[model samples]
Every structure is written in C-alpha cells, then in structure tokens.
Target: MYQPDVFAFPEEGQSGPSLLPPPGVLSLWRVDVARHCGQAARVAPGILDAGELDRAAHLVVDADRECYVASHVALRILLGARLGVAPGAVPLTREPCPSCGGPHGRPATGGGVHFSLSHTRGVALLAFADVPVGVDVELLPKTGVVSEIAGQLHPAESRELAELPEELRPAAFGRVWTRKEAYLKGEGIGLADGLAAEHVGTGPRPGPGPAGWTITDVRVPTGYAAAVAVRAAGQPAARDGDRRR
Candidate 1:
C-alpha cells in the first residue's frame, strides 16, 4: 500500500458521496486521497504509514489480491482517519463470499459501508461509501472495438454511441461502458448478468423510475475512462451524472 496526499475536509461538513454506498455520513470533511502508480515505490510512506499495511503481505497471493490489498490499505487509512479510528483497527478484509461471483464479487464488512474495485494497466480504483457501489475503468482501444461491441452495451447506449461523431466514438463508448459497468456492480451482478437486457434506460430518466442506481463519470487520465455506480436511498441530490468530474 502507498500513502496519498491528504487534504482537510471541506468546511461544509459534507464529504462527497462515492458512486457506491452505505454513504459515509459521519463527516464529509475527511479527505481520502489516492494515487495511480506502476509500482509500490511511487506510494508515499507518510500516506500509507506502516500500521495500515501490516496485513498487505497476507493479501498478495495474486494480481487481484495485490491490487485489492493496496487499494484497501489506502482506503482504510483515509476512512479510519475520517472516522476517528486507528488506521490499523479499521478492519479491512478480503470481503468474504462463498457463492457470489461475477461482477458483484466484492467482499463486505459489518458496517453499512460497501465498496467495489477495478483496475487496468497499473491503476486501481476503490469506490467506498454507505451504499452498494461498483466502479470500473478501461483503457480505450482506438480500433472499432467500441462500435463492434455496440451490441454489448444497452440499446439506447449503443444508439447514443453510434450517433457520436467519428472522433468521439471512443469517448462515448467509454462513458456508456463505465456507466453500465457501474450499474451492474451496484446490482451485485457484474458483466455476466447480461447488462444489455437488464437495467437499461432504467436510470434517472423520467418515467424510468430510479434504476435504484447512481453513476458518476470518473476523470482518470486520458486514454482511460471510468465510472462509479452507487445505490442510494431517496434521490440524493447527487444522482446520475452528479459526480461526473
């Protein structure tokens, strides 16, 4: 695990809601910083701290395990500081599940917090909060893969991407892919759940009711597109596209 640059929470006493949830309501003022790195050396020791990563050795059995350990360590430290708990006592675990698999394969802790993680290249992203959350990022391929995968995305999403100008196809496809992925993650049923058929257009669109999901476009570096999906109660003011930064 690596340390991230921490910042003071905003004076407003409201921390931003991640796309996924139990929606940490304790205090919005806590800032959990993150970084994208190709190797562990890039992480700052001050941010990661020793105690936070004590369990990291136990988590590195595979590539996914490595990513999860690093990501969890980063999140626990940030969230622990926010919640006024000792970073090591924050209780980060592998998210136990004996049967569930596919997109919703996340591990859960006892508290209301829920999270989902995804990584591509060397970057990993963790989405955590009080609601069920799922997040994904993809490094865009300049080929016609997006167009070819049109049938893979929801019908409306496919149409939207098709309508995009030639140069914008990549971006449009990335957006829809991330959104659909995030939605599926929130549902606890990843891509194997047939995304094109279920939850399509079931989002914030009127007459569609609330898809019981929220999506935020994540602004990762160029060539990589990402989105976060969170399930929330009522309609948080920050609904679909609300977290599109």
Candidate 2:
C-alpha cells in the first residue's frame, strides 16, 4: 500500500513530516481552508503570486474568495514542505498542452514531483506523487441537476445511471463526474475534450481508466464525492473497485 495516512493540515504553528509520498504512491492531504479570522495569518503569507491574489480578488462571493485564497495557500505550504523550500519560492508554472501546445495545461512545478488539487466549499484535496496526478472533490449535486446532466455523459454511463433508483442517481453521478474530471485534468485536456469523450463507469466504485492511466474513488467526508487519477509508470494497472487509500 502507498502511504497509509491521508493527513489533515497541521494546525496553525504545528510542524509535521515531509508531505511528499513514496514513489508510485500518492499522498492525499485534506485541508479546511475556509475564510476566518484565526486562519488569516497562515493564509496571507502563503499567497505567493500576484496572479493568485488577483484571481482571488475577482471572486465576488465571500465564500468563493475564501476557498480560492486559502486552498491555494494550502497548496503552496504542502509543496514547500515536500520540496524543502519556502512556500513563496516553490517553482510553480503550467505545462504546455499535449494536443495543441497551448500555454494553458497542467499546473506544474520545476522538480520531478507531480501533484493536483481540487476544492469544494471550505475543503480542499491535495494529491502528490512521483508521476502525473489529478484529483477532484465535489459537493454532491441535487437529484434534478444530476438528471439534467446525465444525458451529456458517455452513453454507457448514462445507461448505468438510468438503471439506478432516482434518489441514488445523484450520488452515482457525482462519482462519475469526479472520476471523469480527475482523468481529464491529469491528461491536461480538461473539459475541452468534452464530457461524453470518456467512459468512467457509473457504479458504487470507479471503473478502469483510459489507457496509460488509473482512476479510483477517494473516500471523503459525507455529502461529497472525490477521485484521483494517476499516469502509469509502466506498472500494472491499479486494482479497481477496491483500493480506497
């Protein structure tokens, strides 16, 4: 098994172990990056780049602003801990797109380590590994919203959802959405590739990844759905519908 612990961020002023996971293993960190007075000191200093600050400033909702700033600050702190650098000094950039060579692609760091981040409301998930990785955390949608979007997913996935009981389909759709987004984010194509482009099965557990990748559900707090996708390093595909850590 990879690192067994899915750690919460250290409380303010507390120190902890290196945040990097073992090679072929992923370290997933759960952070409560909400906006509040007590959390401000730790958060403000970690807002390293002007771009982030500007983006955060443009978020009109108080909660949206809070999630953007605090989660990004948390990302830098975790990356700094892993790399032995000051949070502000971490080399953060974007990789070129694999398909169009566009400047916007996967967010990246200069060193070999790979990571991905996703946040919903007050919480964020940070994933780290030696190989390319992507993760997503989402608030479960309402039953009606799930029904409306179900038709846009892969045909097989829609059929699977159609077979599920009405009340169950929302959670089921959340799983499928998280899985698909995780894989697309890892591939650096994102929604530009379209939702119907990939078939991540709609089931109690995740299905197999597209070639050269592995997808699995991430066990998160109730009322949310989460998943992670990792690029293969010539290793056998991860066992699906079982690996939760």
Report the C-alpha displacement of residue 99, candidate 2, in angstroms.
2.7
lDDT of 2: 0.75
lDDT of each: 0.52, 0.75
Ten-residue stretch with the least lDDT total in model 1 = 26-35
Worst 10 residues of 2 by lDDT: 236-245
Best by lDDT: 2
Question: Residues 1-245, candidate 1, lDDT per residue (tens digit)?
Answer: 11212333222212322322233531111122223222332342433546445654455545544554445444654555445564445554444321353322455555656666666654556666666677777777574886678777556766766676778777666766776776666655556445565433322221221256656666676787677766675543323243221
Per-residue C-alpha lDDT of model 2 across residues 48-163, encoded as one tens digit per residue: 57787888778888777777766676677778787777677778988887657898888999777788989888667788888888899899999989889999999899999999
The runs of at least 3 residues in candidate 2 whose Cα sits more than 4 Å from the true structure, single-residue gaps closed, are 1-16, 35-42, 234-245
Error of 1 at 36 (Å): 6.8
TM-score of decoy 1: 0.59
Give model 2's TM-score versus the native structure. 0.86
Name the top TM-score candidate.
2
